[model samples]
Target chain A: MKSSRPPMPQLLEQVARSLAARKDPALTGIDVETLCAQLRERPPPPPAQPRWQDALIEAQIPEGASVLDLGCGGGELLHRLIRDKSVRGQGVEIDFEAVSQCLTLGVPVLQTNLDEGLREFPDQSFDYVVLEETVQTLHQPLRVLNDVLRVGRYGIVSFPNFGSWRVRLSLAIEGRMPSTPALPYRWYETPNIHLFTLLDFLELTSEISARVVRGFSLVEGVVRPLGLNDNLEADESLLIITRDPPLA
Target chain B: MKARLRKYDPPNSPTSVGWTKAFTWRLTPPDTPWQLECGGHLNEVTVEYETYGELSPARDNAILIAHALSGDAHVAGWDRDASDTHRPWRKNKPGWWDAVVGPGKAIDTRTFFVICANVLGGCYGTTGPRSICPETGRRYGLSFPKVTVGDWVRLQARLLDHLGIERLHGVVGGSLGGQQAIEWAMAFPERVARCIVLAASPRLSAQGLAFNAVGRYSIMNDPLFLNGDYEDGQGPDAGLAAARMLAHITYLSESGMHQKFGRRRRVAHGPKSGFGVEFEVESYLEYQGRAFVERFDADAYLYITRAMDYYDCAESWGGGDLATACRRVRAEMLIVSFSSDWLYPRAQCRDFAIHLCRAGRPVTYVDVPSNLGHDAFLVETDAVGRLISAFFNPARKGWSI
Candidate 1:
């Protein structure tokens, strides 16, 4: 299908310029100073304090252990871990801007959606796979949990406890969606899709034959020992689970 | 340091390597038979390479640059003459990626020692189809046992070992070269510190294999081929030319063709055309094919394309599992793909990137927009070079700049 037309005007112009120019555009190489200027324009994110989940997980993670944080938003907690705990911190964040922010902070982060599962990694590649305040927002929480346990030696699962007394009271008495400090979203525009309580999460781990290594309960941003009615009283809950090794 | 079609240099004419020098490594290790993927073995193999810049005292800043199909060891600059006259390839030819491999360019020879080697089953100085077979005392020609990407990678590792380089700062390559880079990182994980893979995937696509199959068929069906036994003045020039033309098509973008050649014919006079080249693209392809026929060996083409086709790094390492195969890699990976490369396609490279990520390996994947097709890595200089330098900042590691 060859027609008898002349070379395109754009093509002719480019060739003419290419022939006339001494320093070809393709060979001019990047300007390091310009890159530095551009990078300076977007200053690194301000320093921030660690999340409550960081303290909860930090107590268990040994120094120099490899830790991967799934749904690591802006990688702040991972940055703190790398800085203070002497751990190798890697993060998988879904948000593009958040990943860029992480890069600015010098925290290693990969962009990927958690709902699709962590099928990219081999078995037990990391010491810990953490999902802080993010599991309830996932599309396939069960499959993601399986993936977390498959890749990391220890899996840390933390979420806002939906069965907390405040949430229960808000829903039952006021007949409105809970607006607690942790679950800071309206009913119509909330990202928390499969929200579950501490009791429900425990039941799930047991159903899958997962061995519970440790647990934590936080009420009103403060770490508190779980009582008999922890599911109803606690605002936030965390668990450490070790998956039984796959069949040989 | 421009990326352009090299000016015509007469074959056998004196030439000069403008920016770099070359060397040779004899790959003969005791008890290791230089085993290849297709069950072939070479006892004594010679590898020709070009080195740039000075190596660090710690020997940690060495980077291996793998050449693509039809590419030789002359990656940057031109060597007019080699002290080793036994080498049969042109020494003075300008390097394929000269713009990207210079002193302050993307790979930046000023900061790291760069090593570019001619691959096995190539027509260059390496032990390939044109090299003399020790047993027969003649050229290997078609007798050169089929080689694979795995063979290229293994022989390269031996060459590095001979150089006393315990570990490489990075393994960098594009196209077929990228395949070797991935294999190096996967097979000899401890040796490679980083992988700079541009426009490459872990395995060849079905369509890519089909394209290569057509090229092989064209060569094998030629009357002058004589089952790859043709020599001297008698060779399969026509078949090889056709194969090169086919390959050239895959290396170009539709947008590029439309922008550059379009429906443009070679001549504007009254139409009385019969069978000759009518369009500009046709003429360009013909010239490319003829120039390639003058330089490349037909037998080498058959073996190398087959090697590229047979390459399945994931299957070779972990028995059909990609993630498991990549688990051994210790180097951080930087993967780049072009938008116009329909040949390798973004989906394939993206899948590879995703696997690297899932394996918990450090990776940064960039999809750059371009009209240069598969050759964008070689041509889209300013943008690609900046991306590479930014991604490969050794400044953070406290390496002396």
Candidate 2:
């Protein structure tokens, strides 16, 4: 088989880079007091969840439930689950800064690309696979959603609504891609390539033979059961969806 | 406080733990007996162990270090008279993972109390096949009870209990040691707060089993084996050497071997037997085998390799369920895999991390790209050490600083 790794010289260079980048070279000499003091100065991370984050997780989680947070930035949501709901929490995030933040909080996180598909995990491994505010940025949303349903008993997805009335007003008046409180980035720079509304999500789920078991809408950081006008009124959505059961 | 540069050993004087220290805990009569995995039992088990740092008042901050197949309690450090001339290839050989477990090391001794013990089936002063059996007044030899990674973890726990340590702040091990670390978290989930497993798989690969089996057969086929009944000092050294040579192959990668030895001949002008020791690789392997047999027990090697082969995290608490097996562990895990480790490949280690996630356990996985094969877990300490230190220093989701 062909070599899957870099040549020896390149590998040595990589090793050299790591050795040089170590926080402390005194692998056996530094004192504990100095290390602990250095750790403390690293400003304590935010102690509580933001309003939007709290609203996104307001849905009741059953006791002993297991949750996986996709794009679990700093693991704030998962940490909250372990603390308040007393459930197990896991995360899949790729960003280094975010992963380090998650590590500092002591959250179990897989530093892997979500877009590659959750092929590594077994079927229905988690009670709930949560994709909060990260679905729009996904390169393969349809495939990821399908994998989510397959890997989790229940998949909870939350994302900013592209169909909000404010978004429509901006697009209608200015004739440019809308940027609102939800869609905070300009169209050219936004990471959310597949920005779709609640109606679009529901239609896509149905198209893929999945069922939305319980759907809720969050408006101005307040979550409530989904209403007919939620597609136009709600700023975001939190939907508990699953693949439709096979018919006999 | 900086560690004042103290005395150094000969051979260029590499930095040491900066002091002379040796800790031993030998379990005798009053000590609790360890029930074996194969139905046999030992009433008294002597566990030669070394400790670093002071245990916290809450008995936390204790990290149990499980050595690999050939490793001993000497995880890192050098006693005053400890010699480093075991091998001609290495200079000032301190502990196996000295770079990763010192004062400012990843498993920093200054911040966390560390305890590394010679495993039950180990030849390093632990009760092994070479130890005299109290019942028979003879070495157990090949008759040593079949032990598993689970058995090793059980005995290691007793060591903790004897030390008045109710729980381990973390448990860390590489290769076979990693298997024991996993078993510790599984068998006694409440006792371990964190688990660091390096270059290990949940289940032994078929290739791994094949290699181990070959090693076993090499020793058994030797006439000097004497059916595992040979008297002490008269045992089969050649057979043990052959077995170790076989095992050493599995521990390294083809690329690594090529990088280290290549096709160079051992002698420029040499008379050689046509069928033996032609290449430099053969000479290297032979030297490793000879050196290994001197420091290890053939029977102990047999026992430990068997223990490693029998390990499968999915089989026990999970009942063929990875997630279920994971639910049995409360410790957050840092699973590391080397890129070139064919013995326990990166894919398997990644799957382990995935399984832990599936089980809803907190887990982190770091891939250390290397050409060092499975042995990288022991030698490639720079990145691995940093990962461990970073993983351990942070408090878990429920833990308070």
Candidate 3:
């Protein structure tokens, strides 16, 4: 929605015009365009969708549960959690514009690079730690996963399934780095450094001695229980893992 | 020198608040003396304040602004008695914060009723060292009780009560004013719904305290200081000016200073002079110091900067735990720090935000990229205004994703 207020650049221009009309000395050598350029922030990109958000919401986290969202771009999912489930939500994001949006949405956020690790949070400080569509982009996905398990009772992770039929077919037939809707960036420019399939994700959990409490296969906005064929059928996967055994 | 100062809103500008009048609120009577943090009591207390915009029927649209050390209650609009007042500095300029507090500016006086008051121990018609004491018919001078940021908030709350405002929609401030905003949140969380703190931290660093000490030393040691009891027109002007000149350096960035006056000789071809303003930067400081001495009181400077030196949010509010103290704040907060403000570094501001978040408080921290130094909060009005307007009215589409 467009605001009734003029954007900052327009306001500057209006001020300049008014000053010129008055022949005010303040307008003598000032560059309104340059001032406007300094104030302008790059426009934010539209948020993408991954069905894990829907699945997470469907899981219905207990009221007032503490949640920590890593790489919470624009804080959309966290905002939903706080509004719908009454969970205490905090966000960590590296993007300046995204952090500003989170604050505008009344989300508690810290602007710090996730590569530094979550050293600020104590063990089991949060009831749930969420990593959405941001795992493959990390330098050490396994180390972050371990830290997530250490800092939260449950870790909810969502990532694109590289073994999906479409991705595999494109790589096999086209003989080029695959570009699907989920992973649209070219190989040279892609942020995903550790792309893995659902099976690979399950193997990672076992490698860390973590238990998969639940798993879901998400395809074209439809969510289903993880099945034997999910390694190739699922376009994306959402896994709920924990260091401790599942509660009775 | 005149060109260096900011341009003010014309008397007839549509966005200008136009003519404004100051009001005095007698908060404390002789019988009911107000208590101070130092265990001193004020027999009589008065606060000079000004308000712009109309209060909503519900009285919920009021935003209280706190000013920095050298600021006054005249936050916006042309002071009606500027020329009549002793302080000639107020004659032409609208107000210190007129940039963001006009009719359609950042704080948007048209939408929110804004109130700003001259702080205690200030010379701007507020009860201070210069005001005649009720108990002793003479100027308080050095007899004035010490004031803290907490005391300022308490007195402001009384002022609000007098105005019949049970709660504030927001409290906004920069520099020392920012500390007041933080104090308001922790001291009276329920009173303020939102707070915007620009270019401030939990407390003054050791280095900051040292610099303040030197400024105070300069004032007290002036040959004409007369132990802070000199005549009204003759007390420590030289001392105060020197102190101001020294402080002026801290408020600027190295790069900003270099850009404005990069080894430029004022005379262009002057042989070695004994001791005068030869360098452009020195000339700039001399003007600033002289201008500051014209409007500010030497005794009040000692008292106010002492108060600033004493402020420590963690020690006062949280038993020395910032996160614990932050737990007391219920208001949504927006903390802004400038990139080049070495006086209150961005890292310190970040730590403050971190503690607030650790306490599970709703806070938005932004380190705005600027080379304007500590004074960026005032100079970078456009950026600061945008953040404040967006924070106050979140429904407005200031940033999209």
Question: Which portions of model 1 miss their true places by more than 4 Å?
Answer: A1-80, A83-88, A93-248, B1-18, B28-37, B82-93, B267-272, B397-401
**What do the candidate models score in CA lDDT, each in turn?**
0.76, 0.76, 0.82
Better structure of 1 and 3 per TM-score? 3
Instruction: Provide C-alpha RMSD values for all models, in order.
Output: 17.3, 15.3, 15.0
| Ordered list by DockQ, greatest first | 2, 3, 1
lDDT of 2 by residue, A117-210 (tens): 4877778888888888888999999889988988888888888888765465345433468765567676778998998888899999899788
TM-score: which candidate is best? 3
Instruction: Using lDDT as the measure, name the better of candidate 2 and candidate 3.
Output: 3
Q: DockQ score of candidate 2?
A: 0.25
DockQ list for all candidates = 0.09, 0.25, 0.16
lDDT of 2 by residue, B186-205 (tens): 99999988899999978889
Q: Which candidate tops lDDT?
A: 3
Interface RMSD of 2: 3.2
Better of 1 and 2 by TM-score: 2
TM-score of chain A of each: 0.75, 0.75, 0.77
